[model samples]
Target: MLVHHLYSGGKDSSLAAWVLTRLGYEVELVTVTFGLLDNWRFARETAKRLGFKHRVLKLPVEVLESAVETAIRDGHPNNAIQFIHEKALEALASMPDVVRVSDGTRRDDRVPFLDLPKARSLEDRFNVAYIRPLLGLGYKTIRELTERLFIVEIRESEELQKADYEVELRHLLRERGIDPLEIFPKRHYQSRVLGWKSL
Candidate 1:
């Protein structure tokens, strides 16, 4: 079956894509861009290294910003992050010939996680399977496995301005003269694979 893996060039998403490949699925690495700034090229490079096809989907900055604004008003960035993820899934589910959609969400992931109810509804609505290969693994295990398979560059989330959903949203807010700190929490981290070495 064909699987569209939501890729971020980060450990979890990369590992999720790897897992799907190992399971004999034809995997395509997909990175969604919110039309402000993005590090999607890194994800494309990682997909090339892993021998997978890559796609970049662009979403309107205004759409994502609305979600961020709502989340900030609600007192948590998780709501904004999850909103973007759900929208991404919804977009992927609408694509022709895409029967399976997957992401890097883990059991311990609080932000950007699709709850069971949402997952079921997406499946029912789109007639597609939503897969999260890293859903059962914790951060420690994911880190260990990633170390063995890829050379990664870790950085503070704020430093990687276009690396993930939150960072991109922060950039948008800043461009509009709003303080990101007024919305997002402190001390977030992000990772990207520099290269992969055979284990």
Candidate 2:
């Protein structure tokens, strides 16, 4: 079966895609860009390095902005992130020849996660399966597996600004004279993968 893996060029997503590939699935990497400002260079480069077909899907800034606004209004980003992920899945499911959708979400992932109800709903709507290979793995396990499978260069989230979907939304909020920190929790650390060691 063909799997469209939601890739962010992070360790988790990269590992997830690698796992699917090992499982004998035809895997294609898909990265969602919120606006024109944040070019997904890292994601594209990682896909190239891994020898995977990659596609960049441009999502309207307004759509993500609306979700960010709602999350800020609600005082938590989980809902907003989940909304964006679901929307991404919907977009991928609509693509021709896509039989399955997958992501790098792990057992500990709070945001960008699909609850059972939502997963069931998506499967019913699209007649496709949603897979998360790392769902049962913890951070330590994922990190170990990543180190074993590929040599990766990791950068702090802030340093890799605009590499993540939330970064664009944060920038939008900041441009509008709002403080993203007020909405997002303090000391939230995310990472980006620069490149992987050649096998």
lDDT of each: 0.83, 0.81
Q: Give per-model TM-scores.
A: 0.93, 0.91
**What would you estimate as the lDDT of candidate 1?**
0.83
Error of 1 at 148 (Å): 0.8
lDDT of 1 by residue, 61-85 (tens): 7778788687668766777888888
Q: lDDT score, residue 35, model 1? A: 62
Query: Clash number for every model?
Result: 0, 0
Report the C-alpha displacement of residue 38, candidate 2, in angstroms. 3.0
Q: What are the per-residue Cα lDDT tens digits for candidate 2 across 1-199?
A: 8899988887889899989988999999998987656557678887888888998888877778788778778887778888888888998887778889999999998888888998999888998899999999999999888887776665444556324577776777778788887877777666566556555
